[model samples]
Target: MIQKNKYLIGVIALLALALFTVPCLAMEGPDSIELDSLAELYEPVQFDHIMHVEAAGDDCSVCHHHTTGTPVQDENCIGCHANSGEADEVACSACHPANRFQADYLNKIDENYRLNHVDKVGLKAAYHIKCMGCHEENDAPTGCQDCHTRTEAGDKMFRSGKYAPKGGNKSRKSGH
Candidate 1:
């Protein structure tokens, strides 16, 4: 009876984890997002999700690879993708600093921080490397306005695009 109870509990635990994590992972991230991280350098840029995925031949792994992470360490997609600056104890920038990697950036690390990428790069560097590198490889538009545009209309225009995820609805029944 005890063995049966343990097995049942284990099943329940697995079910709970699946239910919890699945919801978090459902979206293909936001579409037409105006970046707020480095608004000072240039006008806020809008990101088009559907266009990029289509350009990449429908392979989600190109960007979502952050979820699986590099060989050295495993990180949840939410950890780096969102990287909300509003909250205390943020994880992204301490390791991936906004400016270049230096002793100053390393000094900011929390005691429990885990170093994942073999090459140390900052949050700014990560965005530029991934987005620009892909564009350069594909010979796609790399113009300043081509990727992102100024959020001149104000916050109202940020998520105005509302790009739908695969399957057409939140159920994600259509499948990617």
Candidate 2:
């Protein structure tokens, strides 16, 4: 009976550890917070968190930008979005009304983007202006080969995934 009880306790502990670790290792499911862009649904591209964490030396602060000189809390992309220097920045919900368009977040543009003829911005331009701009300045890969493969000579990196869902779904309709 003593041996049986010890075995049962060990099994319970193993089960609990498995339940938690499986989700962290799995590429799919909400439990994993990989590739969390508002554009995710529009793209459905699963970011390899394990891969990035390994390559980037486990620095959670690498992707997070905060004015407080501290890392952002987990699962909070908007903290950085709201950190943009633009004076007239709007909420992600304003453009991504129905919570749809899944490249990860609503593809927000600066008001001056339209003034500069960037209103009908596509994924590539938006990503370049917003994400890649910083990555490039930091000596990161501004080219497709850095984050993705180039199937063609002129293929854009923003559209470099296995699939590129066209914009027009009701869930992803533009707020502007």
What would the per-residue lDDT of candidate 1 be over residues 1-176, giving only the tens digit for each residue?
99999999999999986675443332334555565687753576566766665675544446544332222122554466443222232233444567655666556554426754434676777667778889899898777667666454533444333332335435536675
TM-score of 2: 0.26
Task: Kindly list the per-residue Cα lDDT of model 2 for residues 12-78, writing each as its tens digit.
Answer: 9999866764423222313223233544224333455565544444333343233222333434545
> How many clashes does each candidate structure show, in the order listed?
1, 13
**Lowest summed lDDT over 10 consecutive residues: which window, candidate 1?**
65-74
RMSD per model, one decimal = 17.3, 14.7
The window of 10 residues in a row where model 2 has the poorest summed lDDT is 23-32
Instruction: Point to the candidate with the largest lDDT.
Output: 1
The C-alpha lDDT values of all candidates are 0.55, 0.44
